[model samples]
Target chain A: MSEVFIFATLNGLVTGLLLFMLASGLTLIFSMMGVLNFAHASFYMLGAYFAYTISGVIGFWGGLLFAPLIVGAIGAIVERYGLRRVHASGHVAELVFTFGLAFLIEELVQFFWGRDTKNYQSPEIFDFALFSLFGQEFSAYRGFMIFIAIAIFAGLYVVLTRSRVGIIIQAAISHPNTVANLGHNVPFIFMCVFGTGTALAGIAGVIAGPVLTTFPGMATVLGSIVFIIVVIGGLGSLPGALIASLLVGLLQSYAIASDVGMPELLTLLGISFDRNHPLNDLWTLNLPQIAPVLPYLLLVLVLIFKPTGLMGNREE
Target chain B: MTMLKVSNLHAFYDKSHILQGVNFHVNAGEIVSLLGRNGVGRSTTVKTIMGEVEPKGSIEFKGEEIAGLKPFQIAHRGLGYVPENRDIFPTLTVRQNLILGLKGKEENGRWTIDDMFSMFPNLATRADVPGGVLSGGEQQMLCMCRTLMGDPELIMIDEPTEGLAPKVVEQIAVLLQEIASRGVSILLVEQKLSIALKISQRLYVMGHGKVVYEGTPSSLLEAHDVRAEWLEV
Candidate 1:
């Protein structure tokens, strides 16, 4: 039991950090632009697809290096020529634009990469196991993912808190007009932030593609979970996102690892419902069976108890 | 030489016509005040000149046309604005706020961070504290100092002493004088008649979105009819 708990924790940490890589970018963009990019996950899909194609030609290292840059350039162009135009129409328009962009991107991906899953694989260097614990071997790639996520988080935290450009970006987040009046090109800053954010999402996609499976629906699988993490963490709060990601990751990991469920709970409480009861499904439910809905359940709870989120200060 | 000249400038907020044919000019090393009651377009005039509001007429800065430029472009060309509400970045520390005010990476500006700290010791002690936690007066000082960090040739301040302790207002008045002494022209939008009368070399009374009265401070002191008609409640 202890071994199961230990391995679950390690796995949860890996999953949580990967989610942060995507959540941080989404939160950054939301805070800066005051609009959520509905197509953020599509950018992740593009990263995976792009990496698959690049890795096929030049190897995994080349794909890892260049896919994010390509996605970032695409993101910048979308902000400059796409979102910027819709911005004047209002917030609803911006949301719609991103929503449409997501569909367009999905269709485009299907057209380019086909509907089938690609044969993307982890690098041969990480194919070996990093260590053996409790009769199970943990792959080096999972450890690598955890390391990269930490490095990205540390780098992002430093740049935002300790650098001059980071200060300007922070100021712009709260007061774009004043920052512009102070002589910083705020629109350009917006473009760069959007680009960088999408690039971060792209990096997540590159790292996650092989493990999660590279397919047209890869984005759909992780996209809603990313939104849940952002909201539960508190919209536009970096630390909130980090904590929420870990919570969701651990909750799901533990749920899937353990066999505890309604049966055990009812037995412990000395209460049992008739097997023919209308709510038989509820009595028979198990933790792993509902692992997929745990994050959503947490989101609902957070929204009910703390509407502003864990760290979000904005009332609306 | 004219540091800023606005002639026949018209700005509309979705056809409300906030500023209509407003004309004004500030000279080098001089402090000019725009005085009027609320909704008289005193704030709109400065915002229009700063490119926050779209202008339909001529705005010449140092003899160069700057009518259609963006706010940042106008700022880069040596124009600074301190808005009425003191729109400080609340989450940023006072020092970070000042740092963001510096134009680009170079520290060649006439005013430095140390200059701001020395001028407002209250801000110096709370340099690491977030702007949101500062007192209203401290935030106002930080806003002004942030603009000063940009080192504009002409700075337009809108209602710098709106809500403050009398002591802080006096400090702001003294700082304005010190700023003007360094040859940075000022276009002040103010509500308090005494501060404007004391600090401004010339005053423009705005009414119905146009300059209704313009004269030296002493001359305006004697113009009771102008004050009663345009400035007085």
Candidate 2:
């Protein structure tokens, strides 16, 4: 039981960190544009699909290198031609455009990838076990994922905080006018940031697809969950997203690992429920059965109590 | 020859006709002030010139029509605008904000970070601090410095001393005089006539979107009726 708890916790931490990868990009986009991207998860799906197709022709490593490039290019083009055109219409129109885009991308995936789950298996190089803890082997691919996520996070932090381009991007988010006055091309920067953010989402999707399953509905499954993570962490707060992802991951993992349920609570409270009762099903619900809803529950609780999120300075 | 010429400029916000057939001209190396009461379209005129608003007129800078250009495009063409609100990037440090204006790949390369810092020493100390934390006077200085980083042939500053301490306003007047001395044409949109008169070589009193009066700052000071009717804020 103890081993299961520890293993589940570790796996949850991994999952949460990966989710943060998607959420961070979404929050950046939101802070700059002031619109939550409804199709952020769709970009993730597109990344996975792009990788899947590329890996077949060029191998897994090459796919990892090229897929995000392709995805980022597509995102840039979309932002320049589509989002920029619709910006004058206000935030609702932008949100709707992304929502419609999410739907269209899902359909596009079905048309191109043929409505079936692609065998997006991990690379042969990372198929072996990296190490074993308490008689359980940690797959090399999962370990690779942890490394990539951390590296990307560090790289993003540096680019956003240390480099000249990063400084311009950060400035553009708050004072695009000032940045432009400094002889910088603000619109081009916006296009680049949007592209980079989408590409990051794509990278996350590419690695997560094999483990999480890649299909037409892959985007639908994780789309809102990423938003939830971002909102729970606080909009535009990088550290908050990291913290929230881990919190959600651990909470859900514990919920799944523990065997306690409503029955245990009921037994402890000395309450007896008849099988004939109309609410019998609710009383018999198990901890594992409710694990999937934990994130949404936390999201609601956070929204109610702390609207700015865990670290967000601005309210949604 | 005029560095910038505006002819029959008309602008609207929704259905409101804010700038009603405005016309103006700024010669090179002159500090021109646009004086008007609140809600009289002074800021609107500036926004229109920067392409931050859709305006119906012709605005030519360096002899090219730029009324239809976007804000970024206008800035790319050696035109700098310090908006009424300053609009400093809150998340970015002062140095970063200053550097942001240095994006154009132009040859003239007029202003540098050191130039701005030299002009505003208070900013040099807060180079690492975000613009959001600065005092009103410091933020105003940062906004001007940020614009100067663009190396603009012309700079349109809206209300440089609208809300500030008397000392800060005095500092701003000195800064404006210094900037004007550097051969850059500056359009100072100000409510404070005394400060504008002190720095600007030329002045235009605007009312209902039209340039009601234009002359040397001495003439504007002499015209008591125009100041009373159009600029007695």
Candidate 3:
């Protein structure tokens, strides 16, 4: 039992930190632009596919460095030519534009990479076991993932709190027109921010591709989960995103690791149902079976109780 | 020399024409006030000149045509605006707000953060606090000081003393004089007749989107008919 708990925790930490990378970018873009980029996960998908192709030619390290930059440039171009034009038409137009962009990107990925999953693998340098716990080995690649996520978070916090550009971005988030009047090019700032955000997502994709599998359908699988993390964490709050990511990650990890089931609960409550009863499926349910639904359940609870989210202060 | 000039300026909010054929100018080292009652397009005139509102005429700043430019472009060319609402970034610290007002990375601006703190010690005490926590008067002072950080040749201030205490209003009046003494031109949009009359070298009385009368402060004091019709409540 203790062994299961330790391994679940380790796995949860890895998953939680990975989710934070994607959530941070989504929240930043939303706060700055007032529009949630529905195509954010699609950009993540692009990163993985780009890394897969680049790594095939120049090795994984080369792909790791170049893929995110390529994705960031594409993000900036999308903002400049696509999103900016629809911005004048208001929020609905922006939403539709991004939603359509997601579909367009998925199709583009399919056209370029095909439907089969690519055998993207972690670097050979981290192929060895870092440590053994309870006779089970833990790979160093997972440790590397955790390190990258923490570094990104620390770097982001310092830039926002202590740097000049960070202060400008915070000001632009609330009062864009006022920032522009103060002699800063706000539209240009928006483009850079959008690019940086997608690039962050690209980084997540490059790292997560090997662990989570890289395929055209990879985006569709993780896209909604990323959105749920942001909404559960609060729309545009960074700290909230980190907290919510860990909560969901741990919850799913524990559920999958544990063997607890509805049958045990029913027996403890002195309730019994026939094998062919209408609700027998509910009676026989186990924790792992419902792991995927746990985040959504948490989302509903958060929305009902704290509509502003855990740390969200802004009403809009 | 003319520091800022706007001739035959027209602006609209959707379909309604807010500024219709307005004309005004401020010479170097002059304190010019645009005075009128509410809804008389006094704020609209200044906003149009600052490029916050779209204008359909000529706006020449330091002999360069600036009409049809974006707000930041206009600001980069040395025109600063302190909006009527004092739109402070509420979440940012007062010092951070002042830093954002700096044009680029240049630190040799005529006004520094230290100068602002010394002028308004209340802001100095609350320099690290968020702008939202400050009182109405302090926000106004911070707003004006923020614009001054950009070191503009001409600053357009809209209703700086609109909702402040008498003592704070007096401080702002003194600050305006101090700013002008440093050779920065000012175009003040004001509702208070006495303050406008006392500080402004020249005054323009606006009515129905156009300048009804333009003259020196003393001449406007004697023009009781113009004041009663366009300015006085």
Window of ten residues with lowest summed lDDT in model 1 chain A: A307-316
Task: Give candidate 2 misplaced runs (Cα > 4 Å).
Answer: A176-183, A272-278, B104-108
- The weakest ten consecutive residues by lDDT in model 3 chain B span B103-112
Show where candidate 3 strays beyond 4 Å. none
Clashing pairs in 3: none
TM-scores for candidates 1 onward, in order: 0.98, 0.94, 0.99
Q: Which predicted model would earn the best DockQ?
A: 1
Best lDDT goes to which candidate? 1
> Global CA lDDT of candidate 3, please?
0.92
Cα distance off (Å), candidate 3, residue B9: 0.4
**Cα miss at B185, model 2 (Å)?**
1.5
Q: What is the C-alpha RMSD of each candidate to the true structure, in Å?
A: 1.3, 2.3, 0.9
The sequence of per-residue lDDT tens digits that candidate 2 reaches over residues A16-132 is 878877987888788776768898899999999999999999988888889889988999998999999999999899999999999999999999998989999889899898888
Chain B TM-score per candidate, please: 0.99, 0.95, 0.98
**How accurate locally is residue B153 in candidate 3, as Cα lDDT from 0 to 100?**
94
DockQ of each: 0.91, 0.51, 0.89
Q: What are the lDDT figures for the candidates, one per model? A: 0.93, 0.86, 0.92
